[model samples]
Target: MIPEFWGNGIAANPDNYLDEDEFDSSYEGLLRLSERIGDAKPKGVPEHVIHTLPTKPYLMSKARSPDERCTICLSEYEHNDWLRDLPCAHDFHKECIDSWFKNSDKCPICRRSILENKEL
Candidate 1:
């Protein structure tokens, strides 16, 4: 069997592990890979929903700091960097996670549905 490498370490599958009901992708993981190809919005996570999430510039403080770097970019954030607060309360560099949300709507660390809480 030949394996397909959808650029950037993502792959396609027919095993149905993360089917629509389980993970909400129209074509397993390929839907996300396509978003990378041309910046198109994935079917399930529309731009409107993306806009619904709360985003703001980072404000460093003793209580709230960029202690946690973005899981997507693997770089520490500096003060004044933009941040996106997911419905799960976990935040990430706006640019890093914004690109990420364009592909998938799950929180990077907790895998929570980004739309679970509307109060954000």
Candidate 2:
């Protein structure tokens, strides 16, 4: 057989289509089931870990540039805005990032695990 597809071995298998028919039910149902079963996704970090994230008032003088904005809120940070600094060194508004931690344990920009130094 001649090599037709170029990457990732997906082309090697002739039946490459997703079995969507088997998954036709709404995603919300699956999400709810997963939430109840507690296995569809990896668990997020503990609340204490989130609460311990370092935060400081935004100081324009400390920023590398004035154009820095929180990727979560997509707004240029204003002076004195409370911001949380992730271990990856990325910062976001306190409210913005705190809300984010409720759902994920990784940095939004770099995807670094926020569980780095925490126990449990």
Against the hidden reference, what TM-scores do the models get? 0.54, 0.66
Tens-digit lDDT track of model 2 for 19-109: 7775535889688766777876666767788888899998777536745889998998888999999989999999998888888899999
| Per-residue lDDT of 42 in model 1 | 44
Per-residue lDDT for 115 in model 1? 62
For each candidate, C-alpha RMSD in Å?
13.4, 7.1
Model 2 TM-score (2 dp): 0.66
Candidate 2 residue spans exceeding 4 A from truth: 1-32, 62-66
In terms of lDDT, the poorest run of 10 residues in model 2 is 1-10
The number of clashing residue pairs in each candidate reads 0, 0
lDDT of 1 by residue, 1-120 (tens): 434555323455456345656654458566776666764544335567777778887666766544557778887766788888887788888777778866686888998877665433
Q: All candidates' lDDT scores? A: 0.70, 0.83
